[model samples]
Target: MIRGRFTIYLTLLALSVIFMLGFFKQMFVMDVHPYNKDPAPRGKEYSKDGDFDWGTAVKYNPKQKLLLKDTVENILHPIAPEFRIGDALPDTVVRQIHIATSWRSGSTFLGDLLNHNMGTFYSFEPLHFESLSMSTERRLDLMNNIFKCNFHNKEVIGWMKHASKGENNFLFQRNFRSFKICENLLPGKVSCYMDKFQSPICSMSPIRVIKTVRFRVKLAEEFLKNDKDFPHFKMVVLVRDPRGTMHSRSHHSWCSGEECINSTVVCENLEKDAQSAYQLAKKYPGKVYLLRYEDICMNPYEEVKSLFEFLKLPRSKGLDNFIQKHMFGKESKKHPYSTFRKSDNIYMEWRKTVDMGYIEKIQKDCSIPMKTLGYHSFSSPFDRDNFTISVLSKASESIWPKNLS
Candidate 1:
């Protein structure tokens, strides 16, 4: 008993010293810019066939992409030049990319694929912060804080408040790996690894890829312009056919037997998700990369290669080997997309498995988005439509937001 007490006392003493050191560095060395608490306007929500002129969605100037290289170089304040274990990063340059989608939509699979690349410091949905019970704008703001590395922000603080309280297991799970990967950059090895598992790719990586299925498409677009808050960013929206999506969700008994053998909310959300993704690609020409789940499943190599090029990441042989191994390996089922079967068969499984009536309804509700995403009707399942080559995109520009302007 005395030994245990002595151990506890020493631990406390060590932590106290570390805390003081952090405080000393904060006051005398590192440049401390006050965190921005100014709330940004809530982004426009997704709504299809509405009276709004924005029509499904519109594009940013490709020239605007250059702004990513700009950063706040001159902080005209009294501060010392110093380098710490984890230095403050510049808020410019294309350093972070996000794969945003909805639940059960192959996000986890895509995240796994990105993690296969050594160049990418991949985090599996750090912003999948399930406890932030605030407004959507507030949630986006908190998410911005996370990407900005503002660990002390109220929203971030609350999410990880229990982290130090013997909750290493909780942190490693529940989409907190992204936060912990960043923690690897922080000082002190004992506190981070004393009770937790560290990500293998925690070494100094230039690119950071975080995947989240929480935010809608419109909200993601709003951040395209808010660089001061979000910094250098690129986003990809992963979309799967509504039938396939419903089929995947209905695998569990609780999620089936409502609208189209899945709940009404499920069906409705699928349509909304498609529209949201469609709208973003339509409006933000070079801003958002909309990837179809079918395309990835059909040709994971080509599709992922295209995305890597878009994100300007070099082709990684490690990623190629990972995909090759998973494509044929009998890896026990973990992700929705990972299996012994080829991804080609996974894309069109819904057509053969789901009811014909359900397919028609999903197609009807999501026709534009379906067509926009290269998904065809029951009448033409083999057509394999492509959105980027469609005239619909050109037509969409005419309906751009005009009334207020």
Candidate 2:
């Protein structure tokens, strides 16, 4: 009788323990809140009337608990597992991108388009605050480090702290939720943001982009070869017709330097960069993309689709809406710096506005680059004025250096 009672008690105790464990498990599952509960399904276009929530798009894992960190290494390092050796990066890994372009090259619009995607972390001209005193080596290091999401560096931190705040902020036009949150913690927001949010967001984002006109295209070869930290890295060399580029520069007061406005200097850089781009494209294949600003202005939807394809990122509705609203709509007031543009006509505006003599000069100086870039020199004033006569050639018709040889 004693043995039987003891057995019964043991069985009851076992049942109670199991019941308690089940209760706690149910509570844990119910209480666990994901950072983004309603992940707007990938590739599904959001409602035309609704605005896409960028915060939700960040897609921070709900399962991973956030650990507060005081050290740079702890904070900046990505939570994602390292990518193994492969031609294509796994969906889990971030793809680092650089937009190598010159001023007035429609880079702002392009950068914004890329940023509109769900998982992109865009850094706009992080080198805007780059000192003249910085050596080429140091600048390269800074560029590499930015790709690595190491914003804890003093120089990078200084840039964030000193950079312009509003429309002209070099970081990004569309602020991340992390950045917005960190803003509330200021006095030390710059460092605080870099440590707690910016670096981590950048490192974890599936596509990390940095658009800069400061760095030359040739320098990218080093990044492509030397940086093992970012295995899936690519660059887009965004070019525009010199006539359009120069005419656009004329409108802005700050574009006074020889590098900015001089037809000779501008054309020469383009010519050299074209050769470099051609070589890079050949060597790296899919890694180096040459994009013409006019092509996008002409057919934003198709061009952008092609760009997304090149990046191997899925097309999203936010991107579609952005292209539709920005590319087609007419704004009441013109903000020079704003991405808002009458894009369809803006590319051709230089033809009507620029002096014929200046056009002739640009045509002469920029002839080689123009040819390589699929642009044709005007034979006459009528030719320049005639919208029917296409000055742009198909991508295939443009003679690369090897083809020319």
- Candidate 1 lDDT score at position 40: 26
Model 2, runs deviating above 4 Å = 1-92, 131-133, 164-178, 185-193, 395-405
lDDT of 2 by residue, 254-297 (tens): 88778788889999999988889888887776787788898888
Q: Model 2 residue 55 lDDT?
A: 31
Lowest summed lDDT over 10 consecutive residues: which window, candidate 1? 68-77
Model 1: pairs clashing at backbone N, Cα or C within 3 Å: 58-283, 59-283, 59-284, 374-385
Please tell me which predicted candidate would have the highest lDDT against the true structure.
Answer: 2
Tens-place lDDT digits, model 1, residues 136-208: 8766776665565455567655444334334333343323333433343334322232111222122223456
TM value for model 2: 0.73
